[model samples]
Target: MTTFDLIIIGGGPAGYVGAIRAGQLGMKTAVIEKASMGGMCLNWGCIPSKAFIESAKLFKKVADAKSFGIDGIDKKALKFNWKKAAQRKDRIVMRLVKGVEYLMKKNGVEVINGEAKILDKEHVQVGETKYTCDKMLIATGSRPLRVEYKGIDQSKIMEIDGFFALEEKPECVLVDGGRINACEMALMLRYTGSKVTMVTESDSLIPFLDEEIRKFVMDKIKKAGITVYTKSEITKDAEDGVYVGDNFVECDVILNAKRRRAVLPEMGDLELEMNGHFLKINEYMQTSVPNVYAAGDVTKQFFAQVASAQARTAVNHMNDIKETLDYDKLPVNIYTDPEIAYVGFTEEQLKQKGIDYKVGKFPLSVNGKAMIEGETEGFVKVLSETKYGEVMGVHIVAADATDMIAEAVMAMRLESTVDELARVVHAHPTTSETFMEASYVAADRPVHI
Candidate 1:
C-alpha cells in the first residue's frame, strides 16, 4: 500500500488540474487515470472538433476566395483531405497530452494508469494495489447520455465517440440534439459538403442562447440549406434512415448528440449524496461526505473552464484558503460557424430574477473591420442595470465572438459600469469597437448603433 496527501480519481481537466495545484501547495499528489491523461475534451471532444472546424472554415473561405481579391484562384481546384486533417488533429492532441504529462512531472504529481475504486472516503483501490490520502477528489467526469426508442439499435447508432472514428464522410446525416455539439456538428458537416438535417426536442437550436441570438442562428442554419425539425423526436429507426416524428428522412448516418451525465466510478460501501446522476458539490466543490470533493462535469456545470475553476477552488479550500467560485461571471461559448459567447446573466435570466436591466446592441454590419473581412453576420449586445448602468451581461454572435468575450468577462468580474466601458477608447476599424459602441448605447448615449 502507498499513501499520499491527495489522490484524484480520473485525470481529465478537473482531476489533472487539481493534482497540479495540490502538488504546488507542497502536498504530495497522485492522479489515477484509466485511459489517456487529457480525457474526452482533449482526445475526442473539444480539440479534435475545433481542428475539424478550422479545416471546414478554411474550405468555406476558399470557396469565397475570389471575392477576397484573389482573382486567379480557382474554387474548383480545392479538395479536402480528411486523412491529412485527421492526422493533424491527432498530432495536436498528442502534443498537448505530452505537455500535460510534463506539467504533472514538473509539479511532482504521480500519474497512475488504472481504474480507481474508492474503498472509503480516504482509501482507494486500483487493481490489487491500495492507496490512501488525506483527501480524495472524484473528478471522473461524464459520458454521453444514451437515448432509447422503439426500433433503435445501440450498435448502429453513432454517438460522439463513434462519430469521431468515422473514416468516410456520410453523404447525408441526421444530427439529433439542440446543444452546442449538435449545432457545431450540423454546421461542420454542412460546410464539409454533407447533406445535414438537424432534429431536436427543444423548441429551437441552442435553446439556452439569448432568444434573438438563437433566432439569428436558426436563420443562418436555414440559409445553409440544412433542414431542421424542432420539438420533435426520432420515432422509428428505418433501414434507409430515421423517421423524425412522422416524417421519414433519408440519410446515410444518424449522429446522436444528446446530453451527458456524471460517470460515477466504483465506490464500494461509500454512499455519496447524488443529485440525479451527478455527485452534488458545494460552492467550494466539496461533496456531501467529508474530505471527499467533486468537480467538473460531475457536478452539473459541464464545461472545461468551469471544471478547471472548480478544481482550483476545491484545492484552495483544502489548503484552508478562503476562496470560492462565482458562476454568475462565468463565460460560456459555442464554436459554430458564427461563434456565440456570453458572460453574466442573460436578459431572460435577469427578468426572472426581477432585476431591472437595459439592453444595448451594435450590429457587425456597421463595423468597418467586419465589412473588410466580409464576415458581418452578427452583433454585440450588452445588458446593464437600469439605475446604475452596471454591465450585467454581454452576448455576442460573430466570427470572433468567442475571442472577444474575454473583455466582457473581465468587465463583469470587476463590476464595471456601462459608462466606464463606453469611455474606454477602442482602436479604429476593429471588431472590438462594436463592443464599445454597444456599451455607449447601454449608457444611453448611442454612437454608431
Candidate 2:
C-alpha cells in the first residue's frame, strides 16, 4: 500500500496549482489527471479560444489596414486561413501543457495518468490501484451544459470544445446562453465575418455586471453586427432553421455557452454533500467529509483565476495556515473587442445590500493613449462609499482592461479610498490614467474628464 501526504484529482488549474503549492510546503503530493494536464482552460477553453480571437482580431485589422496609413493594401485582396489559425492554437496549447508537466516534475509532484475515484475520505483509487493520503483534494472541474430541443442534430449543435475543433468557419451561427463565453464567441465569430444570432435565456447578457457596464456591453454587441435575442431560447428545429418560440431563424451552426455542472467521478458510496449540481464547500474549500476538499468549477467558483485562488486557499487550510476565501473581491474579465474587467461590489449588489455609494467615471475617448491607438470606445467607472470615500468597486471597458483590473483588486484588498487613488501620481499619456481621472471626480475635483 503506497501512501502520501496529499493526492489531488484532476490536473486542471485547480488541481495542478494545488499540487504545486503542496510541494512548496514540503508535502508529498500526487496529481491524477484523466486527460490533458492544463485541463479545459489551457487545452480548449481559454488558450485555444484566445488564440482564435487573436487571429480574428488580426484579420479585422488587416481588413482595415488603410486606416493605419501604412500602404496601398486592398481589403478585398486580404485573406485569412482558418486551418493555419487552428494549427497555431494547437501548437500554443501543446507548448503550455509541456511547461506544466515540467513544473510538476520540478516540484516533485507525481503525475498519475488515470481516472481517480474516492474509496474513502483518506483513500483514492486510480485504475485498480488504491492509494492512501493524509488529505484528498477534488478538482475535477465541470462540463458544458447540454439542453434538449426538438429535431436537434448532434452534428450541427456543439459546445465550446466542438467550436474549437472546427476546420472551417460556418456561414452562420446560432448561439445559446448569456454568459461570458457566449459573448466572447459571438464577438469572435462576428469579427471572422460569420453571421451570428445569439438567443439568451436571461433578460440581459452577463447579467451580474454593473447595470451601466452591462448596458454598454449590450450596445457594443449590437454594434458589432451580432443580433441578440434576450429572454429567449431555442425551442424547436425546422428544415429552414431553429425556432425561438414561433419564429424560425436560419443558422448553420448552434453553439451553447458556459452553463456547467460539477464533473464528480463515480465514488461508489463515499457520501459528499452537493449543492445543486456542484459540490458544497466551506470558506476554506473543505467538504463535508473529513480531510477532503473541493475547488474550482466543481465548487461554483467558475473563473480560472478564482479556481486557482480557491485551490491555494484549500492547500493553506490543509497546512493549518490562517486564510479564508472571499468571492466578493474576485476580479472578473470578459474578452470582447474592447475588453471589460471589474472587481468588488457592483452597483446592483450594493443597491440590494443598501450600501450608499457615489459614482465616478472617465471616458476612454479622452485618454491620450486611446486616441493614439485609435481604439477608444469605453470608459473607467469607480464606486465609492458616500461617507468614507473608500473604493467599493472598479469597472473598466477598454482594450487592456483585463490587465489593469489587478490594480483595482489591490485597492479594494487594501481598503484604499478614492482620495488616495486621486492623490497618487499616474504617468501621463496612458490608459491607466483614466483610473486617476475617475478618482479625481470621486474626490469632488474634476480633472481631464
Show model 1 residue runs off by greater than 4 Å: 153-155
**Per-residue lDDT of candidate 2, residues 309-377 (tens digit):** 999999999999969977778899889889999999988888999999999999999999998887799
User: What TM-score does candidate 1 get on C-alpha atoms?
Assistant: 0.98
* Residue pair clashes in candidate 1: none
Ten contiguous residues with the weakest lDDT in model 2: 146-155
Model 1 residue 206 lDDT? 87
How many clashes in each structure?
0, 0
| lDDT (C-alpha) at residue 420 in model 2 | 93
Question: Which candidate leads the pack in lDDT?
Answer: 1
**What TM-score, over all chains together, does every model reach?**
0.98, 0.98
